[model samples]
Target: MTYEIALNKAWDKIAALASSKKYTVKYFTDIYEVRISDRMMLSISSDTPASEDIAILVLHYLTGFLKYGYNPKEEWISFKDIKGGQSYYPAYQENTIKPILEKFKEKTDDLISYLTESLEGRIVKGGDVTVELPTFSDVYIRMVLWHGDDEFAPEVTILFDRELTEIIPSEDIAVLLFNLAKRISDEL
Candidate 1:
């Protein structure tokens, strides 16, 4: 399967796993979105907007949490920074982040497992352009994960270290950064 096909498949898998409202921009070709919500907690997107890609999942949370929502063009501080620097996510938000973090963990783990099963670690190339997996799938997959170099950015580098990017992308590195809008709505 091609990356585009794999990407699309990834979308279907996640949507199946997450039971929530799904939306589409229409303007973007074939690009669809899924808005996950749990009545007892939060909606992945405050507006319930989602993209077919997981990057949309990450984007939904990062900017949506702000009282006024985050602007797309602006730079943002990821969850790791917030977690690392006591100054990022204030103490008052601790309880709020707990469950969402758990959900994020669950979603992240689900994707990783799905990819390992589907990809079989036998191919490293994207989409239809394929390459055979070396004798060591573990080591080969890890190398594929480390495509970019920006070590000082611990938030970005560490994931490739764990072979997450092999499954997910750099855009949605940590699930914690995602906004649990459904959770926020449920609280209200």
Candidate 2:
């Protein structure tokens, strides 16, 4: 029976490790992934609630997968292809995609200034454009800002096409990104 348990032991182990993301909540199933997002949604805006584990599990396993070890680049294979995968986000040539592509390029440069690293994510000069990033975490942020006023809801989109950019935007994700930048900067 998959149920919730206080993630003391798991978190304890995580604390011993040098990682910032601690698995404090326990899942009684084989969680393939864990997401930190709004735990609940109310019909109205006044339904304010805290974020909680929106975990994706595999089967019966005590601990969920550790994303730290999961290379963000790997999940981006099909998203990088721009033409494959079971389902897809249409990149019609006629839409505002052209302008969005241009803006995305500008944003990539901005990220380069801070990240000091090269990634698969890039903005094509012309043609059908879609946001593809090293991690599934980055796709939404890329789209939201690029979409701007035309943006839909300006919130996270779980595009099942692939984990093109899952820029978690969580404390742990922030810490990881900063550390990654730091590590890259140190190399320079």
Candidate 3:
């Protein structure tokens, strides 16, 4: 579907729920402020508009969360682990993973600093440099990077909370990661 159509459909779904109280209680406003990263915030309300891509992401999260409720297991799993994530992995790698790997391969320290300080991520144990970042309230994405050796090229893996599929579909997850990779790459 076109982004505009998808956005309107998402808004319609949220409107059908009748009240924004649930959202306000969780996010502090009916406008539904969403953090794309620590430095980026998008408001998901008619009065406070956003770009179609961002609006759809915010609204999709709101609608899906309303329907499924937030219940993160705190278990981190790779994108391939999500339902249908395997089929989507090739495109995901090209769109999300490859860009990140290319950008950060040589600037590992810069990447780590950006992830930790700018994005409010915390360094974790894994790969050469790993960080777990909160993409939304209580929802985290883990990025693991392995600098290349002579035998292999550098690699990057993005992971999400295991229960995320219960809230948003794999398609939305892919968009989220794509946006994230773009955002981070753009910043540094």
Candidate 4:
């Protein structure tokens, strides 16, 4: 189905599930907020071009929550750990990791600074440059970058929380990583 159609369907599902699940819709001037039962579940802004994608992702999260409940397991897991992940290894490396490595080959520090300062990421004590970043209210992704010199080429690896597989589709996980790489690589 087209993204627009899928999004509309998502909205319908969201509304129905929200009512049955007692999720209260909190009105915001520029954003949408949903309170599931008592706890606030999602807050997404409508002022950006990516708002549609955000809404769709939020719907995915809500549906996943309804299906699996909250797993709460925070173990860091690589792409290989995700379902059917191994089959997409080449695409993941080419589409996500390679670009990051290329962009930050000589400017690893700058990327690190941007992620830490601008994105509110925390530097982890590992890799040449390892950071833990929260891309959404409920999603935390880890990135490990290894800068190369004369001998070796630069490399990057992205890992997701173990619960992420249970929260969103694997393809969406790749999309999130791609968005993150673009944000990090874009001239600022």
Off by over 4 Å in 2: 1-76, 80-86, 91-100, 105-108, 114-188
lDDT of every model, 2 decimals: 0.32, 0.29, 0.74, 0.69
TM-score of each candidate structure, all chains considered together: 0.20, 0.23, 0.82, 0.77
Better of 3 and 4 by TM-score: 3
lDDT of 2 at 160: 18
Which residue runs does candidate 4 get wrong by more than 4 Å? 19-50, 66-69, 149-151
User: Residue 5 in candidate 3 has what lDDT?
Assistant: 74
lDDT by residue for model 1 over 18-113, one digit each (tens)? 434544322111233434332111233353433334344433332222123222332223333433334444532354344433433445444233
Q: Tens-digit lDDT track for model 3 on 80-175?
A: 898898898899999899888877876778888888887788988998888988776667788988887999988898888888888777888998
Alpha carbon RMSD to native, model 3: 5.4
Q: Candidate 4 — which pairs collide?
A: none
Candidate ordering by lDDT (highest first): 3, 4, 1, 2
Candidate 3, superposed: residue stretches over 4 Å from native = 21-48
Report the CA-based lDDT of candidate 4 relative to the real structure.
Answer: 0.69
TM-score of 3: 0.82
Q: Which tens-of-lDDT digit does each residue in 26-111 have in candidate 2? A: 21111122222322212122333212232211111112224433233433232223333223224321122333334345454454
